[model samples]
Target: MAFTRRGILLGMGAAGGLIAAWALTPRQFAPPLHPGEGEYAFDAWLKIGKDGVVSVAVPDLEMGQGITTLIPQIVAMELGADWRQMAVEPAPVSGAYGNPVLAARWSQLWLPMLSGLADAPDGLLTRRMAENDAFVVTADGTSLAAHELAARAAAAGARAVLAQAAAAKWGVEWEECEAQDGFILHGRKRLPFAALLDAAADYSPPDPPVLRAMAPQERAADMPPGAQLHFVRLDLPSKVDGSHTFASDVRLPDMVHAAIRHGPIGAVRLGTFDAARAKGMPGFIKTVAGPHWLAAVADNWWSAEQALARIAPQFAVGDRADSKAIGAALRKALRSGAADRVATVGDPDTWLKSKFDHVALYTIAPALHAGVETASATARFENGRLELWAASQAPQALRLAAAAALDLAPGDVTFYPVAAGGSFDARLDSDHALEAALIAKDVGRPVQLTWSRWQEHLAGRPRAPSQAVLSARTAPDGSLVALGLRLAMPSSTRELGGRLFDQRSGKDALFLQSSSDRLAGEGLIPPYGIANLKIEHVPVEIGLPTTRMRGNSHAIGAFLVETFIDELAQRARREPLSYRMTMLAGDQRLAACLQRAATLAQWGGGGAGSGQGLACWKMQLDDRIGRIAVVASARRDDRGLRVDTLTAVVDIGRIVNVDIARQQIEGGLLFGMGLASGSSTSYAGGLPTTSRLGMLGLPQLADCPEVLVDFIEAGGEPFDPGELGAVVAPPAIANALFSAGSVRLHHLPLTAEQA
Candidate 1:
């Protein structure tokens, strides 16, 4: 691949010459995993103990996604180890665990102009950059895509050596030995793995270790409800027993608790605070002031919080962000802002120049993550080195950010990864980590900083608000001929990239937001076999900063496209399912999902008063495609909109762990239901009107709709199922509402405009 001159210049501008040179150069680093006294390291992904225990190194953060169990299961299956003897440890930042898949997907953010040249997982530039930066970020559902094959390979090598040891003892060729259930078998003889550990450590694995005929898979039919699980989740027991260590659960000797207060959005500065008011308060320690915020350190978290409240620091805002203003900005941009044509299929300009059969507009409010736990981190700064314990999607970036904030080398910061209570991609930012580091340094000891609920809303970045207008031209048969979509939203993805990769402030990132970002327009291209289609993006700069949410742009794009297609079906007086099926001739997997979902949901043709709606989506990253179809049953009543059931059929190619995949899809559906019904807030005076989690209108247990999910068995690469349900639920619910009551709600948090 050739790098463009413009791309090179942009890379140099964003990352200095030294950084750019390092990114392009191939370098090696020590393995991230270290074995214990009785353990033998097998490459970087796994270690085997003398007692026959297999410890897997997980490079991704575990936020209730079962990745800790999933990765370890992969190793156990490949190495022929028993599930009971499997273990997991968080891998440290190192070149050995680099995630080239994520690096290539985020090339535009890190490499800018050279993104096109390095946009493949196997691209030389992508690998070099990811390895050099130790960029093993846990986002975009790329964990399996990045680590699966490598991890399997390592486990296979380990299996080969173990077999060689057992073969020598049995006086037979290693090739004739079979490993099963943590034991090596030859004819009627069997030897446990523990008996061969010493000898296995000394044997050399084959150049290309032999692999099993098939990858690990669990059929949905075999794992019926209440059936015995083939591979139980490793973290479930600890989590249920309250022993799992989350960020807030970390404790250190002599650790002081700190509560922070951040200024409202826009240009702001710390004004005044009556610290004297907290002087007599019990357990109140000194107050630390930053450029734009204040922190109170005390013996306990509650005391620190009370002290901050008593101090009541004030801030002077320069350009406050308001919900009304944000909405107006999106509208203005959609109406007259300069547009960048991001994607095109054929001659859409000529086809769309004339009259169109149908046109519809959609709007989405700023959505909050509303994670169970707010931003929290424990940091210790001593002996000119900093130690941080936090749950971060981008660990390397967080380490670099803390290092830069403290004016220390990257090596000086030691980052300890911890489980997040719940992230939903909200842990991608390291603002809280940096703040904790600053407070720890200021207090000259270990400090745990926990943002109050109000502070979390004030400091946390929400998903970008958006507006889109979709127009379609139909043929004589009422099939789509040409389609055009104009979306107006901030270059939120680019802004997030700037903050994550370039360590730019939110303000600086907005100022440097690019005119066009392919990531921002992700999923805008319709998956249908449309002949002429054009997608354009109009970048708007709302004063409020926005970060990535669970589904990224797909959440918004799928809502827009799917709903618009539903409307077109209604306009043409056609059946919604068949209409979509007619257009999905090129994607059989997606068509199969739709058929399965409709059958599972007992879809009633989505007719008037049927309370049924259907939506489908396909997420493509390189050659991997995760497809899903949702059939939502909903209705409006005196109380409010009530969703009764959500049935989904997913085709993620192969199933690694059926139980985990089902849990993810179910969790994502509920999460999306929360976003569709609530999880939105209005801003006034630069402060969010909704502060507490309860105010976010999140669905409680009673509000959760019954969910049904079925997986389609297909032969291909496995895809992550984490974000598929999230991308399809909103549109399906909206279409259902239309079918039930002829109520066409265009905005997210469907009640945003209605309320």
Candidate 2:
């Protein structure tokens, strides 16, 4: 959910996206506050009960991403509790608990407004796109500010909880006793959390709690030995036992179910449909209709679904609905030279005027998240305050959107993050959450709204299709002289509200003047030392809505950039691995990872039908660097190319939980394997053309290659490991395809015919 580069651009920070603007603004650090309590509340995240149970309110929703467990581990590790004593629940949506890393970058985007230049066109555009500080839990991976904020908050809460317990037990100074192992130790006496809870009920902690180390460390002579750096996931037992309450499981008194049948994105409704047929169905209560929206409310989910199925909703299809036509438009836009320049170095225009050694135009098909779980939200609006429960990565965004729909302040709504069946990027701005809020408000009852798999597929924002024309010019000595990249794609940066531009009000007016080139060209620029480089983006507005996909344009952009670099090596008659090493001369971290991956995969050892390919990249997230390298081995046959093995070496700075990091790498690699091999989307008549699961061509476990993941710490604080494997997988696989055979693929999915 936090992983969309807006797709392909997921983890790649705007290399030079807004460096000048960022430099102009001072960094803002809005730390969260500690909430005092009744009901055992210690802060916005952690709580302790008289029974000695520790509950942590995680801001991010768990979608089988292990975050539910990861968060509990973080809280318990600092709070000195046994695994059995720890519990995790959803935190209220608020900017106070927003992900710092995402907040930092998002704040940069609003520099024009932050600098008080709102009257200017640039400032106005930025202001419109970034109207509210919508707290997002998905950005910065799990290691960045999102998880960092949660961990720090938990540590602080633990210190306070322990301090208060110590003060209450022996009537001693809070600082006199140290806490560990679920007990407050003062001299030779110990007070358990259960016994201290009563006296500490009204205790107020210091502004910031004096926290202890989470992982094992050498402690002062006065304190107990720190805990070990391992955790037994807390949610696993509940998940296995079916005791976990997912969003779909939420049930309130008199709660009714609502099913949605939304029209295709960007389509216009020509007329309204009569609900007579649907109303006749059993359990049918009411029908709601809006522009490009339709919903049926009934006693049960099945009946609501059936009711929707019976009604036929229609929309006037737009011209941009055709996939082939959209692709053609993108290509045309790329050739037009009317675009925005994202990154520029040296004199690329002068170099482009001279001779070029290699040139290629690569295209990638639009892809889908196609997660196992469909989008769902449950809402109950009683009185003025509205409550929403949803599988959202950005709960604050849902609150703001819902509040806007109801014309209320953000404080009027309270959002609870729920367990998602699966949320890739689908929960960024859940339409269902808004729909549920509206339905519940209108019906004057609690309502749970869910989208059918088919409707979800058709209405979901897909990864935008992309085309890049890359040209490289080499000097007489074979050193690269100039590298130029011209990319064309629909705007992925503009949020949901940007779509409805009301010029009269001048609220969304910036949508008309702005180009979403910033998001479209994210990670498209190279981090390597290319003396003369030019990266430009042609913003083509395809009518279809696009959201962040994992690796957001970076996956496809990396595929194009890495494969093209390989092509340049082939043109120069130099080995691909050697060429990459030469290009990455000064970057020791990336170089080390690359060399390690090559050594592990036994690069250049492939012979006959076997081929080994290598690709490496540096992901810049704000000030941090996430370096990764991958080597893929494959065999080509008449049927297609079979990926035999993939060896990856990653340097995400320090390691937090090795198990979770390893899982992220392996899972990310498998996800990339699916995108590189298949799992693409097509469109027609303003809707997804491919509806069935079989047509999508997702890679199963059988399709996953044997992946060997290795971690290489560069000796720094812990960094983000969320999108490392996902970002590196596609390009490495593409490079492997090139090595496997003379047939080079310039498009995605490396179809059977292409293979």
Candidate 3:
């Protein structure tokens, strides 16, 4: 019989406190099996119990991507273990679990930039790079590849360790035994892994274990036979049964409730009213204030919120307060800013001057993550031992930040992972976690900090608004000639106050004290072999608080680039699909994806009054690159353009779970469509007015059309299926509108008036 241990479920009253202490404490936080107590340990990730149960811990957060299920599924496949007998949980914060892909990328980019290490020998620099292993996690859906590799390696290591233990127990040569499905096999008989558990006490793992290779025969044998055998979503049953634990479900003994009422984003401190009246409110506890924000703690959340409503705070406004002026500034910068050229193959100045081919300029407004669950955290500071339970995508980063805020060593802090309803970039900037820590430290008790919807809207960093001006020249014979694109946007790394080293002064400084220009553009520029091509970025500093969104810079840039490509095809009187195929000369992967989508959607053969449009995007995130294409069908009339159907084709290299991959594509498409057609968030007086759901005009069930997704398995390596839909949906919608005889959409959030 298979047995599973459920976590603590906090209900109410004194009994709940006792349950929390018994089941949710860190003493129970270790892996289900103890290393030295009748268990075989295989590194930090895998532990096999004497009872024949296998438990694995993964570092990836479970934010509805089904990572908890996927990680174990990968390990079980490699270990030849019974899937039904495995248990998985979140791993503790440690360097051993760091994502290799992210670590490699970060080391390559920032290691040599150190002041004293800039001139270091290549071998020493390489050694230093290998020592750093802190991987930054964001909700942008790019960590899948690295996590897959890491999980597989961990499983392989466990298999090797088990082989060694089995050899010793049977008194045979190591090569004389083969382990499969939790059993060690000798010539004609097999011994259960549990029988040799005691021998594992003296087993020492090999220096470098060989990982199973991805040969063609191995690939065919490993194909998941059904959903049950695949990387199935394991959290679904608990969620459906209403037994799953979210961050808000956590409760501790004598924990007070906290509510924060902070100034708007980028707002400077000015003044606040006296808290004398709030102190008199029912269930009032105490008030905590930071440099630019204040919080109230009470016996209940309602009392804390009620206490906050009685006070009025004032602050100095920021520079991007005027919505109209910010738009004007973006347009002006795109038109006249001195360009910092990124790539140029030949002289495009002379070609553009002599040709009257085609030019399109587009701009996108700012957008919010707009998560269902508002940001919240629970923290406690007791005698220099700080503990926090946060819905953080990057828990280690949050732990480090909290340690820094409390003037405590990192070892003094422990972060407990919790489930989040959603997190595009909300968890990336851990302001709420920091605030909770500070408030708990001051009050000398545990505090659960929550952000009101209004506060979440005002204080949260938004996707940076962007603008682009693309110009192209074509021959009269419909042949390509030259292309030029100038992209401009606020630097996200700089705006978020990233740490940097000043080369001139030999000192470290934040982005505020250094240049804002960055080489990090989100989407891969087009790979077409166009003559006289010039692509550049004009970095601008708009005094607005900005962070990465779902697609980051790629969403806006892809919108402009894809839409312009469609316009060029129209000007040349050629079919959009055919034009793209010609341009994708050597990119077989992208071409195949585009062709597959077109075939699935029946491109150029839509019924009367129905028009079709196609768009494709190639994304390079970390060490993985994948391509996605979308073909849309729509109709235009007095009711405006309505997208009736959408078909998407993806080449993500390798797929672990087809169901989960399809779901990600569907969700991302819906999210992008909501931003493209309905959203209208504006800023005024240094504050966003769309604080609630109704005002944001997000897309509803009625706005959704039929969506079909297809995946192409190239089968070598796997990339994430998270952000491709976000990159392909917006431009596909815009191109569909044009194909259906609507006016060109040069701006995002295609309003009815514009149509």
Candidate 4:
């Protein structure tokens, strides 16, 4: 049986509601691993594979997102076992491998609307209410997210089952033989998990074990930490080998190397080729319809690439929309754009007519997603089935797409993942996987399409270049009375493949689909106290759209909101830090973050060559708050301005790893700065300018700055940190530019004039 929900609401990360539609189950006692052996499954399974080693099958792609690191910790916490002795596996694709929390948050349009503080909106209340039923909890169901709830439920339930099995064997009451530390204990007699497994190997499994909910009051009194506990240790190492295998390091028997002369225009392909020129070349394969005029099948890649150099790629360029024409069109679209009411306040018409303060004009820069690893996928069609070796962040989507395209059952396709060189928000969606499948069909063997540095720059998914305008009206009391904001961003719906949202479905009985009514989110606004405020979002369609660049819309929105606050401080002749704190009167975390970042960056002191500045933001997802301070160091060189050091402070509530989280935050700042400074991508028509990495002028090791990361790891709450990398950089850097250059730069990719 199968159930479907077209579109679903989403929260922060993907959690419950997605189940793998595995066809394998214990009919009598055991089943094989695969088709003939038994059946194929995509279930999130925790197996103690006879070796006494615990392995959990998770579905998310590692792509340097820390999913592998975090999921097992949650499992360890719940299983009450060894965290260091467990192994993490990328669970197979099916209903079980889906990240449902991702679906729910997507349903909510990935809104980062500061939910932890007071005066939360109705939508949050509704979501929290939904969490209780869908999540694991006794009363009002939703407290912790689905993953956390699942761990506790699975652990507690399994304990009860073990206790019953022991009771049956010893002829005692289940309660009398209480389960303790992954074992059954009765009056000092104990049975370890492995021993119990051996004893009950042939028994039929019972309904998920019964468990008495640990209420708040009974936790300390009924069970102390040391009173009875068994901790799980994960069994895994860093898996490090000094020698590495990148996409560039691939080689296999009968494998062929290919080079593409890409389409000069968007939505166009290579229609013709120069085969006659390559007829005399060795190792030359037939010229295909695409960019590769001729593929060279050889024992190695170098020989093929060398032979390919002799062949000329036929230039059959299609209708071209030059960069100039595209930029003009988008700008014109912005000029006469219709205003939308994203935020409302006490009649903005009254405030616009009676504004007592000055106006603030700000513009953001266009940035590219120069992820270290370019798009690469290898596919092979063998026997009656197909196998794929891909490095993808959205692996589940790739599996579904490949199956649909190849006319094969989802099970017919197998996805093998490799360690990601690194992903900086560019691996979300594309026809790359599809393209790999296409080439492999023609070659009739495994083919690896490794994008060169140039190809990645020219065809890579770049962050949509965006712009914002801020206008503020102030009262005599030095407070913002009315504010107006107009922003532009790429259409978010383009990613959903025109699918509609449907929340009500029987997916829980089928593939564990999370119920959410939204699939695409756009135009998000936070609660800012200002009278007569008007905010609107324009669906600006520039060239190649890449919305999944790390922080998504939250990153862009934070930049605009935070920068406008800085503009207000300058206008009011108040310190930027103090001014922002005033706006966040009731928010202690936000207020504290602003203070901390300023204090760390020495906000009031003279900067490297300029002066001090402060920047801060509160992410709606997971209630993440971060602050930034940058001291720009620029010398009189013939070149443009360069920064010396960038410092940041963050408070992500409950952190799982201080080291990993800090590294990400610091890296994110540099990533953001790289875009702000050197990187470049643009729109040539409705299509985005996919610049290759080599052409992007993004920062390299030569220009890297010193970054310091400080964290506020509050022990009171347990929550995942929300988008930390790029959130604090813009505000902090913009402030630095203001101090160093005294220009209050509005646009990003800060020009020599702005810098």
Candidate 5:
């Protein structure tokens, strides 16, 4: 059963003292995965079929992240199964698959009063909360961290039971039999898994199954450029052949298309509309109105969109949001606002009281996700039950929201997860799912709701605008002695937590915004060894609700810290690479990455007119830390600024799938490049001035730079490489522009003029 805060609180009132004890106790849930007729269920993570195919259950979303393949690959390698026999299915929401890592990281959102007690993955409170809520969210790059050990243990157990069955048939010791290549072998006597599945079902595996000597790792030498891979991605062929199913690809009998128009940002309600204008339009069914939006249903998507346009529904806006107001609020807060210390080392207040060597202000405009496919969902309501097919980063949240919108019990809603074309964390919001359910209920049939590109920007929340004043006291050698940062922005992460965990509206959540949010200040602490450093958050509400984007706060924090350091190096007449290396004495991994990246890019000392710049970053979640260094080459031609190449060296410790990791780094660089070039929007009277993707100045194929990526073979715990490249690219490119054109750009996208 799904747990809601209100329901839990009410239960606490009735159960009284027992509720507190019960809340801390661990909860057990039935396995979310069920085997088909010919399959034998081994555990919650995997099942073996009579045909010898091993299907692994993945609890994360597959949004071009290769997670569907990565998890199964882990199971295959650990179970000693052949790669050719591996398959994957999306696991349903259940306590068995709760993501304790993410739940612990986001403890403040769900357990705000006692977040400190539940801030670790293995903590009793964190496990209980995660399992009770089925918090299987697929954000923050925690897929492997949360599920790796569990999946490995499950696979090891399955392998042991299978070996037991094979040994029993051969009258040999189970420990002597080895399972490999989809078969159990003992002195050349072999038996396929299919032959022992029936007997294995009755056997119990060892309490602590023996694991393999090593986890899955691919040497960099084994995957040279253009070399064939041993285990190819299973989803690539279907995607290339156009047979893969995304949320929008789902179709149901007697389904109608819907196009919605949401009011601009602020407190708004749906107003009157000219329904007569679209009454006689071809295939136009009817218009449905909700509190804050309007939708038109028709036989086709194009027709529905046209109907919405023809009707031109209006909305009553109150306290509209404006870009000028947002900027002014940030500036005001930076000048005189209540500051809460996020991170501190030594005594920064005392150091900042004296004169600092350097100070600079950096600004980042609000950016959009600009995903390839807009928000789309297919929902059908009938027989007092709702069936939803959608691609979501938080599927349980989406299901709960849909059920609440329909005033039905949570058990009445069934969700089917599907692939997203590209989310960039956009799928975390469940507004579209709730809208689809409402539309389906109104139409009394299966309804497919798709927001047009225009409507997407109108309704979608953008990344919060930020302004930071960075002050640093440096030594004669350009090494930083102390640093202080005062960042002004909304408590965006807390706002998201309110919406995702508390099911509160955006405006309501913003109303409860606090003056401090550590999640928003992530990555602000430099990896270098600075004696005295302080980072303070000055939260400000700009009458605009912001949500989490791909890189989270690291993208903004890295740009601020790295660029300021580069500027300090230039002012002190020191080489950027050597200057940074001097401060990184404690972090050998980061220093190695910097050295390798500089070598790969052919370091030129970043002399004026050399067209090369350097930046590095580290992302840490719990014990896992991912480090990356980037060297960007850029120059301004007669046309405009052109980035010619980006060379990056990443150290994400152990590599599960080298090819996938490389793809993530390459994609992240380009994604970051896109943000650096454009992807920002300005609000005027609650409407974004930039409406379409073409207007966002996204990098086209011809604009893509030559990306070179390499990984360090440091065998340790694996880290997600998805956000590291993005976090470092903007500052690297900005520093490159400084070298190429002798201009200091303090704003993101390196605009010609500061806003």
Candidate 6:
């Protein structure tokens, strides 16, 4: 029999203080089973047992992104386990799953791109962006910068170092202090890591943990003993048949379901619902309200949904006027002078005067993350306590929000997280689970509230659409002299009050300062080295509540940047490849990737019916380089243009497993393009027009071009570029479409006509 434990569920009212103590009880944990704890259970587990599994905590959701498979491998490799004998479970609610050293390293090559958008003199911020690719050292906010954490890991090698010390004192060489099966061992004499756990926990980690990269001699041996990166090959019985679990399907004796509808955005409406009417209904128990009205204690979800539909709200948009009207207001907001200037390199107006012969005002649009599954959460208030099961990308955020709303201390609420269907970027803004908790708490009953597809489409966070204006001019020699760009729209994340980009300081503030060396504003100039170049962001907040879609909003920004570069190349009568190399005179890796992608795509060998386009990017994060090249191809038919296939060549240093890394790059391509696919998101009212996957204009799989990915590992150095979420794919396809034809597409998602 399998058992799960929950302590301190309730307490007597007479001894009210006892309830408080129970609510605040120290969290229970099941540490990783020592190699001897079991002739059964897992092969390995690590660090925090608060999650009851052998895996690292995940900060983001596992939506379609393959993080579920990738993150566990990192810790398992470090923890010394045969991952094949281990299981990947989402850690409870912790931030330990993050590896800033690697993440910050990848950020260097990218942050510079965002920094170049600053309106500073001579692209001063461009240099900062390049310098702090992973994170800003002195910037404010949550320090969610993964790079800073990397420094801590390296500096705090305290745990590893102590283990080495203990081994050294035991008369064995530190090198012989092999961390085996979570034990510091010397021949037959071994000490379980748990024996030293208490000692290791007290010491402060390194100021900047001195991380020793896994030596080349050690990496091949580091594959968790019997572990091979072939788990993906062992087909799961669930996948091929498309089987999955939705949180609403849970069954408990006397368990019930619910369907909740939230008030329109920004304005909360509390209504005087009729309990008498609902009492007569089959599944109705009672209705209550805190944030929104909820009809709780349902016999069945269907009956509850029916009673909910009958309830009427007594409130309307006051001062905050209309939800529908917000869209229109956003468009007008774009034209308002309140727009902030995010980036300004040179005197763009003066540069345009001397260099640009003409300018093209291209319209770049906004988008959304319409994950196939709608949001859902189930909560039950049994005996003065609350228990919740939810599918949330940010479990910690959701848990905190629920505790705050319920006036319950965070520990009073027990959150049981379910496997998420998908949490594209914006899934972090959790209103779904909180609402469900409120309803269940009100009636003292268990309720599982699910949003309708339409409700999700309108209420869920939609990626804000944007617009950009580009100007390009050529000198008599056909050398590109000036490229001036402006984001006609605003950013979802505001620029920090510092010199470059500022990260929002949340729970992980201090964690981000570690990797500030690789930052942004490096340069907008490609290898061609034209004298004047500029890119600017004109900030315009829609005032409507928005959520992050995935990776960073910068994901879409790369597409715009790459597409514009392609256009500049075409206008100058230069191969995009040659044009990029000239711009990257000082960037050998980027130049090399550009050459590699072109070669793989057979750039110049195209026939009349088929065409190819190329794009390159450099992520100079944490003093490491993660360069990528995108080569896309398509065929022109009498009926319409069709993308036949795409090929991506990436150099994410120290390719842990070529197969897994290849899968990630390929997955990024699909996700990056899905936004504009004809079947998915639609942009209207200066926002994503639709938040329904069925509605977003993404093309079908039949319409999806075949993709082939190849990796050129930068060995000797072990650098992981797991942050490829929003960077390479879109720019690659956009460039390919631009190559297939003369017209340039500045807006995403690339439309068929644009192709």
Note the Cα lDDT for every prediction shown: 0.85, 0.67, 0.68, 0.50, 0.85, 0.50
Cα lDDT tens digits, model 2, 1-755, are 12211100001112211000010012322223232332345444556666667777666777766776676666666666666778777665544354545544444243424633432312423323332354455643633434553355445545665566677656888777776777777889888776765555445444344456444221112221233434656677888998887888888999999988766645356356778878678899988875567888999989988877787766564543678777777878888848888888999999897677778878888888888777788999988889998888766666777888888887899877778876666676567788899999988899998877788778777777888889999976566778999988766644432432110111232242236545567678775789999988887765556767777767766787888887777767777777777878779789889899989888883332457777777776645678888998865566455778989988876555666666777888888877877777778766787776667767666767888888775565555566677777777777777666647788887775544
Candidate 2 vs candidate 5, lDDT winner: 5
* Pairs that clash in candidate 3: none
Clash totals, every prediction: 1, 19, 0, 64, 0, 82
Which 10-residue window in model 3 sums to the lowest lDDT? Answer: 16-25
All-Cα superposition RMSD per candidate: 5.8, 8.4, 7.6, 9.1, 5.5, 10.2
Of 5 and 6, the candidate ahead on lDDT is: 5
Better of 1 and 6 by TM-score: 1
Error of 4 at 740 (Å): 2.2
Candidate 6 weakest lDDT stretch, 10 residues: 15-24
lDDT (tens digit, per residue) of candidate 4 on 594-615: 6666676666633334645455
Instruction: Pick out the ten consecutive residues of candidate 1 with the lowest summed lDDT.
Output: 4-13
Q: lDDT of candidate 6?
A: 0.50
Write down the TM-score of every candidate: 0.95, 0.84, 0.87, 0.76, 0.96, 0.71
What's the lDDT for residue 197 in model 4?
40
Assess candidate 6 and give its TM-score to the true structure. 0.71
TM-score of 4: 0.76
- Residue-level lDDT of model 5, residues 291-367, one tens digit each, is 99999999999999999899999999988889899899999999999987888999888888879889999889999
On a 0 to 100 scale, what is the lDDT of residue 234 in model 5? Answer: 83
Model 3: per-residue Cα lDDT over 1-755, one tens digit each: 01111232211122111011112111232222235455555544666778877777767777777777767777777776776678776776754444444433333234435524422212334223322324435344545555554455556655655677777766787656666677778776677767765554445444344456641111313442233444446778788897777776679998999998776654356456578878678998888888778898898988999888886555554543546766776777788876666677677888876665788777777888888778889999998989998887777667777888899998899988877777766676778888999999999989999888888887777777777878888888565678888877766644443521111110122233123244335452675667777776766656566666777666776787888888888777777778888978878888999999988888873222446777898886544567899998766556444778889988876676667777888888888887777554678867886878666767678768799888777764566777778878888988887767677888887776654
